[model samples]
Structure formats: structure tokens, C-alpha cells
Target chain A: MKIFNYFGNYFSNRETFQEIIVIPVFATLLAIFLGLLLLIVSGSSNEIALKALIALFYGSFGSISSISETLTAATPLIFAALGIAVGFKAGLFNIGAEGQIILGGMAAVIIGFSFQLPFFIHLILILLVGALFGALYAFISGWLKATTGAHEVITTIMLNLIAYRLLDFFLRIPSIQKEGRNDPISKSILDTAELPRILYFLDPNLRVHMGFLIAIFAVLIVYWLIFYTTIGYEFRAVGKNLEASRYSGISPSMTIILAMSIAGLLAGLAGASQIAGVLGRATPGFSAGIGFDAIAVALLGRAHPIGVLFAGILFGALIAGGRQMQVSADVSLDLITVIQALIIIFIAAPVLIRKLFPWIFR
Target chain B: MYFKKFLKISSGAFAGVLLMTINSANAFTACQVTDVGGVDDKSFNQTAWKGVQDAVAKHGIDSKLLESKSETDYEPHLNSMVNAGCDVIIAVGFLMGEATKNAAEANKDSKFTIIDFAYDPTVPNILGQVFATDQAAFLAGYVSAGVSKTGIVGTFGGINIPPVTGFMDGFAWGVKHYNKVKGKNVQVLGWDPDAKEGLFTNNFDSTDDGKAFAQNLYDEGADIVMPVAGPVGLGSASLADELGSDKLKIIGVDGDWTQTDPARKSVYLTSVLKKMDVTVLSVIESVKSGSYSGGVTVGTLENGGVGIAPYHDLSSEVSSELASEVEALRKGIISGSIVMNK
Candidate 1:
């Protein structure tokens, strides 16, 4: 009681705290409560359901290895969600992040396995190429939206389907496919192009890599670009009211195109990070629906870079803990997905959350 | 605030629940990690898990499985199984080869049996289960050749991979063998062993593609069609049902689809069996008996690991003479008197 009051008093000092902080916090709690109820109603004993909940939390942040797992899982999410946030701030719904990611990953893997350049130079080149590829892919959608008034949602969805086939076509090429394997697996990237694990000194098992730091760097850059820069100011202005911003001497088309391109660049880095850091090679569907999940992350974060960072970690925790829950508690992994969907639903309707917990508003 | 009061009460309740002990571990736990097709894909994953269930019912060995939703889940799921201290972890499908190999090396104490893959050097702690599905598929081809009213049988694959092709190759060769034996000019469609080119849907999940391919083969005068695609073959089976067994008969694959998809049993001439469940159960039982060792186990007709299923509802349609000849061919191949392919 005292702890809640103390935190409430501390948070109530800021006007934006209710919408940004309290609402999300309450939404998460409400979702978890409902998830537990779901488990119990679905025929799990009370003890088993409680055990599953504890396993979920413990698997997320219980120890150093668990923390590393959470961070490792969070890396790509943070990168992609930050990109989605940038697009949202410009009033464009860029659903093409998945295609952008696929292109970026494909580009990175080609560069990763093909050349033998110096370590840092090779990695930087691969990342830049990946970012460039993603930016180019997204630029098409932005350009279409700016010039022809085609809906980004439709264009991006179609592009995603094309990207999957494109990956398949590329992977089938004799030069790109792994030697002696007829399967759709690509050649493994060179060691020099690999993203070295950051916690190798602490424990070789800890999979948290340099990508975590880069994701944080991306967060800082996106934060500054969103909150401090003039381009960002224009982006928010266009997002707030596009017709009014155009009348006020801002170029709506330019802002929309630039915002989407930036978004794509960040997402491309995510694909690059996964290839270089975690997977080491591109397989068909290797983006693993991270781009789709990032939409939820961005929405949950209210399309703020800082909020996306935390939301990414929270989602990462859910994934890592979901595995643990499955292993220890013998619960189906689908339960975690249900919980994630519940969280997204609650966050999407913050009014419902605020109404449910009206005393938090007071 | 009421919110704070609720939080306090919940926290207190959670603290109390956290102290409760988890259930004790079971003895001789065998676990499986499924491929992206999942455990219930009516394919290898499902067949492999069936072996574990059979072992549980027979030997009382506890069974568990973690389904891989994507490729990324492979390594993590393997690691989770290792962490859970599973005695034998069965990795289903060839896609899990690298992850299984890495995990086998990392955890030498844990025994692993991977379906559809074998290590080149033979890892000490892993038993690779590779089926001579071609052997069973050869018999299926003979049956198809025998049963086809049009003197032409067709076979196709999901992809140009060896697992799929092995079945197609054997089927084609069996038709050729049947041609030589009966002095009949029975033609094989959709596959040529010499050139190694054939019809492929390039997908294992799309029933639409399956239906189209079957229709094309049937239109080409192939009365019996063998589809080596996993769930995609169900589309052909449904088409066969609509067309009637007299007009179009289907050959099933992986498990005996007559049993797996019993609702459509009447349309099957005979299924090419891979026997993943039989092999998986034997591996688990060997582990239980302390006789488990790491090596590639090739499932062939001689070992009863792979064979053709009984001609269930269509038994009356197949002549006893044809059935006797198939038995002879199976023996002749096992005895090295008959060659399946060039």
C-alpha cells in the first residue's frame, strides 16, 4: 500500500505520467490478471497456473543468464519498433517493415558470406548495405503514397508477399545457397562479419551480443530525431494534421517519404543485426515475424522511441519466459501468445484501462 | 487508492504462492522438439511424437514435447530440452540438423535421435534415423503400376529435396520394374530417374497446388497418382474421393494415411510407409534398456522400418496375383536379386 502510494505521488507530479506511465503499467497488470484467470478457467489447477506465472517472470529476469536471454530477444524488437515509431510519427502506416527487413537480411547475408574484408569494415559495410536495401524498399511505398496517393497499408502488404518469394528465388541460386545442400538454407556468414557476443567474458552461454548496444544507440538516435530535430518537428506536424502542415509551408510529401525511409533504415538494421548476431545465415522466413510483432511494440509504446525500448524488453521477457514456462510448468507456448494479445488489446484501449482503474486517475 | 490496495494484496498472494514446491521430476523422461510443421502436421513430427506416446503407454516413460513455431525456435527449444534434463530428445525433420548436431555436441550425455538426418562422421551421442523410404516407395510404385487402369501412373514431390525425391525415384523405378516383369508398356509420369527432373508443387502446405497437380496428372491419363507432399497430398486424396477409386486412386506417404486420415481410406491403393513411429519407439526403448548407441539407422524393408501399408478398403480391387508379385519383388530386392533404380 505504502509503496504504491509513494510511486503514485512521485508519478503524479508529471502531467503526462498518467497516459504514458500509469496507463501502460495498469494495462500490463490487468492483462496478467486476466491471463491467470484464463489459465484457471481452462482447467489448470490453481497451483499449476500460479507456478506457470512465476516461471514466466523467473525465466524473464530471474538471473544473469535469463537477463541476457531477455536482452538478446529484445534487440531486434527494439530496432524494428523504433522504425515503426518513426513512421507513425509521420502519419504514415508503414506495414512494409517486414519486406524491408527481409531485403535487409538478404543483402547482409550476401555481403556477409561473399567478401573477406577487415572485421569492422566488413561489418559496417554489411550493416550500411542492409540499411540501404531496406531504405530503398520502403522508399518505394513512401514514393507511391506521396506521388500517387496509394494506400501504404495495401502496398506494404503486397510487398511482404513478394519479399518472401524473392528470398526463395535468391536462396535457390547456386552461388548463394549452401554448398551441397538442396534445402533453402543460405551459406553461413564469415566469422569476421559476425556480431561478437558481449557477455562472452561473463559466460560463453550468454547470447546477448553487441547488437544490444547498437539497438540502444538506435534508440538514442531515433529519440533525438523524433524530439529535437527540425525534420522530426515537421514529421510530428504532418502527423498531427497533414493539410494544415502543408498550408503552413511544410512539404507533406517530403516529410512522409523521409520518415518512412528512416523507418526502413532502422528496420533494415534489425534484419542485419539478426543475420550477423544471432542466426549467422538467412533461412526462408528467418525474419521470424519480428517485424509484425514490432507493430504491437510500437503501438504499446505509444510510438515513442524510449517507450519502444522498454516495450521491446517487456516483449523479450515474455518470449524468454514463455520458453521457460513451457519447459518448467508444462504450459503450452500458445498461452504466452494469448497473454501478448491480451496486453496489446488492453494497451490499445487505454480508456478501458483508465476506467477499470479509476482510482489511479485520482 | 484502491489500485494500491489491490497491488499490495496481489503481491502478498504471489509471495505466498512462490514458496510452493513444483511437482517432482519423472524418471526416464523422453522429450521431442518438433519442426515448423508442428507436432500435429500429420507428418513426420506427428509420427515421431506417436512413438513417444507409444513408449509412454508401454514402458511408462514420461514424454514431453516443445513445438518449434519458427526456425529460430530450433536452437532455443533444443537448449530448453537439454536444460530440462531429458534423457533422450528426438528432433523431428531434416531442418533441425544443424541445431541438433550443435546440441548433441554441447550435451554429450543426452541421447538424441533425429528423424530424416544422419551425421556424416556419426556423432557418438546421436542416433540418426534415415528411412529407405525409397524401398517402401518402390513397392508403392509397383502397386500403383499394378492398380492403374490407364497403364500410366504419376508421382510428384513438394520440393526437389532428397527426402521427397527418394520417394518419387523409388516409385518411378518400381513402375519400370513392373513394366519389365509383366512385359507391359506401363508408363511413368512426372519423373525421369535418368534426368532427375520431375513435377514439384514447391510447397508442402497448399492443398490448392496439390489439387491442381493431381488434376493435371489425371488429365494426362494417370489413373493412379502418388503425391509425396505432406498435407498437400490430402488434396489429391479428397479429389480421389470425389472421382471414385475406379476413376482415380491415390498413394499415401509418411505414415499409413489410411489410418491417419481414415475418413478417406477408400481412395488409397496403398501408402508408402516411412515408419517414423516404429523407429522412434525402438530408439526410446533402447535408451530404456541401456542398449542405445549413436549411429545411422537406415529403415529398409528387411528391418521392417519402411514398407507399404495394407490395401485396406481397396483390397478387393488389387488382384491376389499382383499382391503376390509385390511380395516377391520385396523379397527379390531384399535378397539382392532385384534392383530398384539405375
Candidate 2:
């Protein structure tokens, strides 16, 4: 009920609500319309396009099982995107979320496989270790930017390469690699550390897990941190005007470092949740560009926590439904990527969206 | 009168669609979930998909395919195929071993064949298609040894997995077999079968690594190079084009390079074939005939499941004597007289 009330209050703000909610919704519809036109122009028949649309809808939301899959896919996105949103709020473009997630996931997996603790304690320790690893990895970029006045973008991109190599190296270790497998595959995490499936009692096939609940909890905590906290105020203030925030006794360097650390922590949790909940073992390229996708998620959400949550789920729906579209209509999954790119384009140019949908703005 | 005619045409089209749907409802549906490499990879994924296409044409069965863009897509794609009521699902590549196992265990009613991986305990509903590619690679190795002007042949792998090493091991053994038979010295570079270690690019997509490996082998006095890396072998082909066939000849893997790239036909001596299409089609036929059972199906020379492709443009360079010797070696290996691993 409290959550409902929070959403209600958040939606009641007319000016930001129209910009955040209305514009994005229209943009999504427009992108889908354009995507259909693209399919037709690309030589797919009208009948096939209609089947794809129907299959996409049925796969995403028409069944309880599909909704479960969507939520499962969204769980990691929500965590990572929240982290990116925080960085955006602080006027930083931290592209190192990929490295942070990889490092965090690596830490979580090592702890998850090596330890033999009770269920509750083990899971908590894994998540915390993951966050700490992510924080330290992201801290390098933050420290560089704060101290040397170096750009975070360049450092973070370089760090991502290191992280990828580091994962490859770690997977090769005799202890870390799965037993009897020469290929670079990791040991499965202990069941005690697993994030239990939420709806297993109802249906064994439903895969949505406890990490999704943790994501929602993280959203609430981040919402409280960003909107109702002093640190968040400093972050926003520094973002709006760095010199003014520095003059107002909000040390810009400290704010930048702290904001980046918080973002890293969330991204780390994203990695941990994915390892603990979905993929029981880690492999090379396991994060699968989720960190990069979070950047787009944060942009589409306008750097708001609630908005990020919706955007994550929306992307998750595309992924889950994209499979159905492929199976039922024989459409390539690249079409979904095209649609997503289009939506982000429309979202980035809000004035264009408003001009296109004038009645909605009025 | 115009409205009545419009309604009649629309209803006729609707009835035709209904008839088609009913026809397909009874048709055997075979689905495939490719590895991260995708369907048009021109290697295992493409070869395995060819089996489905062949089955579609021969048996008039319905078929569908889902290309996995990442490792995470495996389970979901497999489940989607199950939900779509596919009679059999063929998962391509070793990377999908775990996901295919889990899916097979959960959906026992559905038959499954996983290329390149066989389960340990063996799931009752899944058939693991394991190939004796070493047998074919051995034949290619003997031919390489027999024809080498430099008295040295080289090979490298994409990774140190069993499938890749199996090819390496057989090639080395074949070279050794040639030395034993002819009383001549032929050195095998890039692999030590006894030590079970060799040069690896650690990835299958990098043509640069392939080119570099081929260059290094050539510098080391190897006249022929075989790359077990998937598309990475294309790098070696390109290098051979630059160096000319007199300097270096190449051996391809998974599919016949001569057929895959007809323009570069001169560069390839003979490709070590895995015969994935033959095995994949056989698996589907088993399902259609209600004889599908879970176990390992080994593809070997005796069954035409794995062999060496014919030397295309390089046939003249490979003496007729060496060609017959390769055929003899093939028969010897099939009869268990010529052990692949020395």
C-alpha cells in the first residue's frame, strides 16, 4: 500500500509526469509503428508482420509464464540501470558499469562456490562482496577523475577491457574453472547461496527469483537516497552547476567519488543477482552487454529511479518477447534491437516527440 | 454484388490458411537452437541447420530455428521451442551442454540431439552426437605429411577442448604413421599429442590470430597448416592467397573450405569434415520413425559420418600414390588396424 501511495504521488506531478510518462509511451508506439514499416520495406510480408506483433504481445504479457520470464530478464537490468541513473544524476558518464558488473559477479561467484555457510548468511555475503568489488573497480575511474581531473569516460572504457581480460584469466585458474572441463567455464555456485525462485510452488517452470524482490528494494533505497537525502542533493547540485555546489560547501571531488561509488555498488549487486538467481555459473561474456544496455535504460528513464525500473522492464519485455517473435513469425531478433534504438532516439529528442504528438503535450 | 464477391474471396483465403494449418498440425516439427555463433556461421551451426533443411525437403517435416545471441539465451530459447510443441530440438555446439541437459531432463517427452557433447549419465530423451573427427583429421595429416615439401606440417586450435584436440591428436598421429610407413622424417609443429598441449587463439572468430599462427608455422618451415578454429581458418586462407599455394597450403575444419569459398579453392589441400549434416539428418529421421532414444551416436569413417573432403584444386599437387595411401589409411582406421593415436 505504501508503495502504491509512493507511485501515486510520483505520478500526480503533472509537468514532469507528461515529460517522463507520456512522451516515452508515445515514443514506444511510434518506434513499433516504424519497426513494422521497416519489416514491410525489408521484404517481409504483411501477414508475417502481423504475426510478429501478435506473438510479441503474447510472449511478453499474454501469459503468466512469459511475464515471469520478463521479470527474470528485467531483474539484472533494474539493478544496473539504477546505478547508471545515479551516475547520470551526478553529471558523470560512468561507462565502466560493465567492468564493475564483471568484477562484482566474479567476486560473488568465488565466494558463492568456495564457502559453506548457512543459506541466508551466504547469500548476503555474496551480494555484499559483489558490491564491494564493483565499488573498488569503479573507484579507479572516480579517483582518477577527482584527483587528476581525468575524464571518467576514457578511463572507464579502458577499465572495461581490463575487466574482460581479467574474467578470462580468472576462469582459467584450476580452482575457479569447473572440474574436468578444459574449456573456460566456472564452477556452479553452491545452492545455499542461490536466490530462491519466487513462484516455484505455483509452477516449476516460472523462473522469476528473489533477486527481483531485492531489485525493487534497491529501487526504494535508491529513490530515498536520490530524492530525500543530502548526498543526493549535493549530487544534483554539482550536476546542475559544479562551481556553485563547490562554493556552497559541497566539495565537488568528494561528491563525484561518492556518487560513482554508490553507482558501482548498485551495478555490483546487479551482477551478484544475475549469478545468484539466473545463470548458476559464470562464463566468458556472461554479462552479455547488460551494462552497456543500462546506459540506454538510464537515458530513456530520464535518470529517475522509478523511470529506470519501468525502462528496465520494458527492455526485458522486448528480450523475452523477441524470442517468441522469432519462433512464431520467423523474424530475426535484430528487429528488436532496431526498435529499441528507435525508442532511445525519440526519447533523447523530447521536443521532437512533443512536436509529433502535439495533443499529448497540450 | 461487389461486397458479396469481396466476402467470398476473403473467406476463400481464410479457408486456404486453415487447410495449410491443419496440414502442418500433423507434420513433424523439428526445431534448432544454435549457439552464440548463429545459423549462418558456415561451420557447425550452419552445417547442423543444413540437416534440418534437408529433413524439411526429404521428409516434408516442419522446421523452426532460434539463433542465440548470447549464452543467456540458451535456456529460454530451448524452453520456447518446447512450448511451441516441437517434436525434436537440436542444440548446436558444446557450449549448450548444460542448458540442453537441463531442458531434456525437464521435458522428457520431447526428443533432443546435442551436437559435440554427450551427457555423462545420458538423459533418456536426448541423443548426444559425438564425432570421431580425429579419424578424419588423421587422414588429412597423412596426406599433409606425404605431400609436404618442407617435411613439416603445422596445426593450431581455437581452444583446448576435446573436439579441437581430437583433430590435433589425429593429425599428429597420422603424420607419425606416415613416418613409420615410409621411413622418412616428417615433423608435426604446433602440437605435442603426448603432452596434450599446443598453440591456441582462445577464440574462433579472430582471422588475425589465424593469419599470425599460419605465418609463424610457415616461418618455422611448415609447408601446410591446418586451423581447427572456425572462421579463424579464413585468415589462413587469405594468407595462403598472399603467399601463393607453392609456399603454403591450408587444411580447413567443420566444413569443406573449397565448397564454402570456391574462389580460394587452390589454397586448400583437403578439409577434415565432421559430417554434422549427415548425423543431424539421421537424428531427425530417428525421431520421425519413432526410434529416437537417448544415448551417444558416434560419427566415424565407417559410417560416412566423418571423413576428409576431396582435394579440389590441389589434387594434382597431392600425388595419386598419396591419395591412395590416404584411402588405405581411412580403411585401416575404420578396421581398427591403424590406431589414430600413436
* C-alpha RMSD of each candidate structure in angstroms: 4.8, 4.9
Q: Comparing to the true complex, what docking class would candidate 1 get?
A: acceptable
> What TM-score would each prediction reach against the true structure?
0.92, 0.92
For model 2, what fraction of the real interface contacts is kept? 0.38
The TM-score between candidate 2 and the true structure equals: 0.92
The candidate maximizing lDDT is: 2
Among residues 3 or more apart in sequence or in different chains, the pairs in candidate 1 whose N, CA or C atoms overlap within 3 Å are: none
Q: What DockQ does each listed candidate score?
A: 0.43, 0.38
| Full-model lDDT, candidate 2 | 0.87
> What lDDT tens digits, residue by residue, belong to model 2 across residues B1-342?
643653465455554443342233346899999877568766767888999999999999989889998888999999988888898999998888899998988888888999999888999998999999999999999999999999999999987889888999999999999999999999999999998888888777778998999999999999999998887888988999999999999998888888887888899999999989989999999999988899999999999888999998899988989888898888898898877766
Show model 2 residue runs off by greater than 4 Å.
Answer: A1-15, B1-26, B150-152, B182-186, B206-223
lDDT of 1 by residue, A1-362 (tens): 54455334321213266656777677777777788778878988666676788878887887787788899889999999999989988887888888999999999999999999999999998899999999988998999999999998998889999998999899989999999876678999999999999999986767899999999999999888877889989998888789999999999999989998998999899999999998999988699899999998887777878778989999999888888787777788888788889989987666677678888788
